[model samples]
Target: MGVCGMLRVVQTGIGGLDVYDVQTCPVPKPAIGEILIRTEFAGINYLDVLMRRGEYTSTPKLPFTPGCGIVGTVVELGSSVNGQSGFAVGDRVVVLTQSGGYSQYVTADARAATHVPEGVPSDKAVCCVSSYVAAHQLLHRAARVHGGWRVLVHSAAGGVGTALTQLARIAGCAVYGTASAGKHDTVRGLGAVPIDYRSSDFVVEMSRNEPDGIDAVFDPIGGEHWLRSRRVVRRGGIVVGYGMRTIRTAARMLVASRGRRFSYYSMNTRNVLQNTEDLRLILNLCSENIIDPVIGPRLPLERVHDAHRLLTDGAITGKALLDCR
Candidate 1:
């Protein structure tokens, strides 16, 4: 909350980053089974770009706030939010809102919130909400990767990419990441073999490295990229797609899936229970140092335009967060 009865938020219409603007309005009140959070950090995801550009199939109506996840302290709880919700005022929590997370304060469903472990940092906990959750599901639920398996993660140096690599290593699988040359060291440091997707043909590179075909390929870069990803996966292995560039890209992926397994993963509230459980598991992993989330550049909420610019220009590695405090 700001002075008066106001709160500041990043608002935008359906357009490019330039359409984004910071404005002040009355602080939002929680509805039944909702919680109001004094936000600490909000994740800046690639999905935001898709939504901003009107490329995503679904999006909020014009003049809306765009943010998918956040880490904050619960400040108020609405009616019927009972003890079982495990939320109390001043308790730190991470939430997956799918929108409205870029404000100084936000309201989220109590059921969609998870308590952050005592020792976990806000930055790391925020990553667990969307990036790590998606990575965990893509591997455990979609790909069903196991120990001794080899997997390739596209955008290996990005937020979800970093999470995928780290979690894969923890599961005793060998990991290969395709990233720009500059991010190779970061990928390699995560115990993954880095392939420069810009300079080298990843399909050929993976073929040379694994020859027998790799176990799984986790790709968010859709379209013919999925076709290329499919070529490297072993006969029994699968290609999991998450991000969509376009409907045609999705169609291309499905057509390319012939004679191979192709699975698509989306992080949504349809399975709130499973997502909350996985988020808690990821927070615990972060607390124990089992998997350290790679945090990249952070900017104050007012500088959100720059944050979006950094993400769009591919100038960020790992997760980029907006400091909402």
Candidate 2:
């Protein structure tokens, strides 16, 4: 148990926000090469909601706590900890908690934790571990985008979309993004040409603008969305995906091939922590004020279910964070 005594957490016996039950329990202990953190804030992600609904790629055992990213202060460390964690007690850090991050405290594998640079708010830092990292990877790693390259980002006002748009802009890329009409201004302000997914067909709009095709397209909305995105990429361009894609879409992905590329980027622990160079660049970007997360709403930990509802239902415009403090 942590020095603080009992821990308060919200969990679900089954997969679904409707099934969440708050409970008080013993704080967990850190294992070898781990640190116990008092979670100050946790990022709410679409994957968390999908995991709860049994729709995500993987599901945790019953009665699991679901939180993907956490920013907090380290209070305790386990045996054999050394230079790798680079941590001291009270050090603020952001860790990618694949699951079990919703609690007041969570133990993280030291390798997965990145210390929050001083002055960056925990709210924005939380976005770094999930959405921001995905955006950076999609542009620099997956698509290998460069200056003047044109890219399309679907859901341009959501967490990953906002991050991807801004980062691509930073890379000197021409970004065409899709969002609801209500968020067109937001998308434009972030340096993307906003296409309304509601009224206009994005594929038709994109083709009209760049008939020859764009350098790359980033999509999270699957199904027919992929079909439309596939039609708009240039002959040698790539279509990058990062959301819960449907297996049934494989045939469509193949049909839309036409010598273009389509690849899904999984937001797993390996993908998150393996690319230290990108992660360092992200931190430097945040630290130097080159990139800023578009944090949408802040809610207390108890209101996590509401946060999930808003995010999954397309009500959230940017990243939503839970104030665990």
Candidate 3:
């Protein structure tokens, strides 16, 4: 390894955490229109777990990097990139890598990066990249949530789940979230009524609490859970499915959503403009102290496996960041 060498986590094969391999490789150069970033933090998303397990339909081929979002400082700009791109070397930014974010250095198109606001930390800005962006899109773009509307969020203690809860509350929506009993306080602290999904049935519970049904349901746990979420929504209300933890669950959710007001959301590079706008708004929110991302653990890059293990075990209460510095 030389001065340009960097460490990255690679998924050599599909399976469990054992598939993650830490390797030292030459830092990748920024291609034309790209910017090389010295990564400060990388977000660990549940989608990474799906890709590592070979469960996601969109999972990349094996031996690829596993992370999708990062916050870092621009170190070098590629040829053809200039001032109009809204980026400069030494500027901190948050960008969606889609893959290859799990490294000490990563490159992204300068056009796709969002400037991190002053007063916001790199760890928190990275959280806004993928999870918070998705959460914002799901609430405002997909669900079109309105103040005073009652909404339900599944897996309320996880990354996107916690984001949804906090943002929904900020939007003036009455929120209800389902998580294990241990996380009830976390959901409750976010101003949402917490329902313990383990011991009690959410359908029965929501129906009992709001007999009129809720306005929207943001569900990531798929399959029969989608059907259950649908049953609790009021007429004309929507069930938005954002993640499929299992392939079978996604398939079952699709079959169950037929003839219903069900919507699905998945962020892609094609939505970079919209995503960047949303990311900027979120970073401002963080800067103003209006809303803060519920940060969980901060693990070093070498502890990538331990980070993933904690996330997969559902032990993390909020977004977890990999300290790439």
Give Cα distance to truth, residue 34, candidate 2, Å: 0.8
lDDT score for residue 141 of model 1 = 89
Error of 3 at 54 (Å): 1.0
How well is each residue in 139-208 modelled by candidate 2, as lDDT tens digits? 8878899999999999899988999999999999999989999888899899899999789888889989
- Candidates arranged by lDDT, highest first: 3, 1, 2
* Tens-place lDDT digits, model 3, residues 1-325: 1358999999999998889999999998889999999999999999999888877888887789989999999998999888888788899988886799999999898888888888998888888888888999999999999999999999999999999999999999999999999998899999999999889999999999999888899989777778888888887888998888844456444534534478887887567878878888998999999888889999999999899989888899999989999
Greater-lDDT candidate between 1 and 3: 3
Give candidate 2's root-mean-square deviation (CA, Å). Answer: 2.1
Model 2's alpha-carbon lDDT is: 0.81
Deviation (Å) of 144 in candidate 2: 1.2
Q: Rank the candidates by TM-score, best first.
A: 3, 1, 2
Worst 10 residues of 2 by lDDT: 244-253
lDDT of 1 by residue, 181-246 (tens): 999889999999999988989989988998989888998888777888888988867888889754
lDDT of predicted model 3: 0.88
TM-scores for the candidates: 0.95, 0.93, 0.95
